[model samples]
Target chain A: MNLKIEKVAIDGVLVRMPYNPAFCADEDKTLLHGGVLTALLDSVFGLANFVAIDGISSMATLDLRVDYLRPAKSRADVMVRAECIRQTRHIAFNSGRIWFDEPDQAEVARGAASFALTRGEVSIFDAMTQSRSSK
Target chain B: MTPDLATQQLRKVPFFQFLDFTITELAETHAAATMPFAERLIGNPIMEYYHGGIIASFMEAVAAISVSHGPDLQPPKPINLTVDYLRPAVKGALMAEATVTRKGKRMASVRTACWQDDDSRPVAEGLYHFLLV
Candidate 1:
């Protein structure tokens, strides 16, 4: 997924991913696979968690739920907004929605998830950067 | 339909092709598939763990086949899905089996479980709903 962060606020995050025909379900390449939307939501939720919570380390998705409100039929870019709704020492809850970048912007899917937090010395961001630099 | 025939059908789907899985079993109310670990499927680069979404997608693909599979099959429309992650999917092939819990004229429910090695130790379990209409 070629994702771009469009907005990041304390309450939520917005991301955009261009539509790819490789992710289509039909031979005609008109309709997208529902799993693509689910994957997008999951990724966006992780980003939201990373942005909202000042965590020291990594997190894992405990569960995920996604509802496809409509057939993901469009060549337009996909947009997703996600937020960490609540967070405790060991857990975080997230909610989000997906839509097209076109006008009317009908919601294609809605998702919610919970993550198991692992707070430690190094944040995932730092760890990732350090790993890349070391590599 | 035979598993080989089902796999041939899956090749037509771009998303399924991306997943690169094989239909290992097929029956009236059951479907199973196996997906080998690939770098593209990794969610945590440091740990090289399978992405949660990829696991869910693989399971959903098998679940869909369980509900409908044949030539000129009008694939069921997905309404919703819920996935529970039980364990970390490491760098290895993952297997998923889908069982159709209920099938009606207009709807169907499929339960899917995914595992890496031991069948008893599932990495994830999911429930999916589809609209036949």
Candidate 2:
């Protein structure tokens, strides 16, 4: 749950996670699990949408497509940079790539996702606030 | 791969372990699994809905398991995966069923569906393509 935020810009945000045993596949501990990379891409894409919409609405992923380009090396930090490519009244389109160790590094995976926007409702920021207050 | 080997492979996946996914059934062309509800798996903590990515991961795991148990007897590497979220997954156990639609020398396709309580209403569905190398 400790996702390190590396940078936040108008276009996108960069997030990173350190390699951990909990994130490795059993078949190959030396490689990061594909599911973990998928989750990271999803999270970063959502965050990018949040930034693009200025936290005005809540969004949910409608569909996501991920292509695995390469296996992530274990004991390295995985980084994802996602941006909101476009937005409509009801949907936000996002694209992102995941890499190990550095931003300019070769990508481990690339993904695209669409999120449904819920207008005039509790947003993801609100949920985070509520979660923090309840703790 | 045999059913037992497929199960062992599932156990080896760290994300599966993190989600506490259990393989319920395994066969040549079909596979099934279950994920028990846990607070850590929640995406919207306030709404207590399961994470969309986790649901996708579950479906992908099932698809991979089905292909692994097929005639190839080797776990295929994922080439691509597409997941559709049909409904918000509430706090409860989730079930997934997957079937290999086509199998070839180099590639295979698998479709998977996940439902919480009602099988008719799926929470998520996905198509996975794998490279059998």
Candidate 3:
């Protein structure tokens, strides 16, 4: 699924997912699946890592832990913001929170993840720059 | 719920349907499932590796199914989930097996592992905690 980026800064990113039946858990579509929520959290945290590393490198998740504080009510847009809390030479720690509507609203879930920085021939920044230059 | 009922309920989850995860086996304390490799499941398209989130989702679903089919007989609410990605999940069908370690009145714990080709070599593993209510 394509995640919508609401904002991106040096330290963090905010992503939004408008409720879709594909994201629902029950046949009745009353609840969003926890896996979908985890996917959102995971993406945001990964993007936070990108921002943290100045987009010079790419990373992959080593470990991710999520706590579901409450069921994410169905048919509501969900927003998540993730920030890199710490970084080392080869790893980054990130924290994220999910909300149904407003940012200040009670969180439906929270998560933390650690990512391993990958040294690759192509950096995300390089790809973006190349794409923009081509355009 | 009986194992059969829990398995049926698991199939109803939209994410499971989206990922094409099939519950291959369901027992009182254990559950097994499989996910076919697909382009949509790729996290690193350049590398063609399964997305970590997709793998975690698969593991979490299997863990939940294991608990749901246990003596509790109720669908669980996830309290927390931790996934450790040991290796890049390459292009192939991935299998997951989950076993319940503890089932209490209010909480339950499950451990799950996923493998692509070799059952002994896991690509990822997870520990899941759920609320029994």
Candidate 4:
């Protein structure tokens, strides 16, 4: 199935993935929560992996070291910049940063990640069926 | 599993281990996980929202539990984690949801969101990666 991917440009690299409020508070007028932020960063990192790595494979997060430079300003459109630094046999390393509309100046969060790649069975059915109801 | 087992596993995680954090789930998985906040977590102003580091810990916890739900994700560990702070988390319980994005033998990804119950909006959003290692 085609994932609903969202794209935003930054520093010459094109970052794309599906990122929506999914659950934002109307009163606060802010994004859903910190877990959602983590999910977004994870998505960008995965998209980087999907782009850098080919074929069907299962990967896990070895380390996702993130530093919150600043809390996102209220009611701002946030964008992430992800890059695959290096990919090796059975292991891939990458890093990326996110910012609100202000690309050069403001930063929402920054992180570095590593993934172990291996040939294994993956069920697309399970991926699609897991949380469609919850959404 | 039991709380002790979960604590042991959570401690092994590099990021979790870094913070000296232990798992305190108000409820079981496939539902809701309420993680209590500690004093050490506040990096910024003490009275304001929780420190970003604390928020990251919460995101990581959600991701761990989310991917662990998958049968094949035995000995699941984080590969990547990205966090976005939407707002400040004041003094209170932090709520989160860890959703599995993909699960393969080699690697699996999960998404999680964190928020305070009172505001209804999340303080941060995160994506967690778990490698079979």
Winning candidate number (lDDT) = 1
Best by DockQ: 1
- The interface RMSD values of the models, given in order, are 0.8, 1.5, 1.4, 14.2
Overall lDDT per candidate, in order of appearance: 0.93, 0.83, 0.83, 0.56
The 10 consecutive residues of candidate 2 chain A with the worst lDDT sum are: A24-33
TM-score of 4: 0.43
lDDT of 1 at A42: 86
Tens digit of lDDT per residue, candidate 4, span A58-79? 5545555665555443455566
Q: Model 4 chain A, poorest ten-residue lDDT window?
A: A18-27
C-alpha RMSD over true interface residues, model 2: 1.5
| Candidate 3: tens digits of C-alpha lDDT, residues B18-133 | 88787888887899988899988877765678889888888888898888764435579889999998999998899999999999989999999999889899999999999987
Candidate 2 structure lDDT: 0.83
TM-score of 3: 0.90
Ranking by DockQ: 1, 2, 3, 4
- Name the runs in model 1 displaced over 4 angstroms: A129-135
TM-score for each model? 0.97, 0.92, 0.90, 0.43
**lDDT, candidate 2, at B40:** 84
Q: DockQ of each candidate's interface versus the true one?
A: 0.85, 0.70, 0.69, 0.08
Q: What's model 2's lDDT at B16?
A: 71
Give the alpha carbon lDDT tens digit for every residue of A1-135 in model 2: 578888987689999887788877655577776777787888888888877876456778899999999766656788899999998888999999988886558888999999998877657677796779888
The digit string of per-residue lDDT tens for model 3 on A13-114 reads 998888788778777886888988888888888777777775336787899999999888756688899999998888889999998875557789999999
Question: Best to worst by TM-score, what's the order?
Answer: 1, 2, 3, 4
Residue A56, model 2, lDDT: 53
Off by over 4 Å in 2: A102-104, B1-9, B70-73
lDDT of 4 at A127: 49
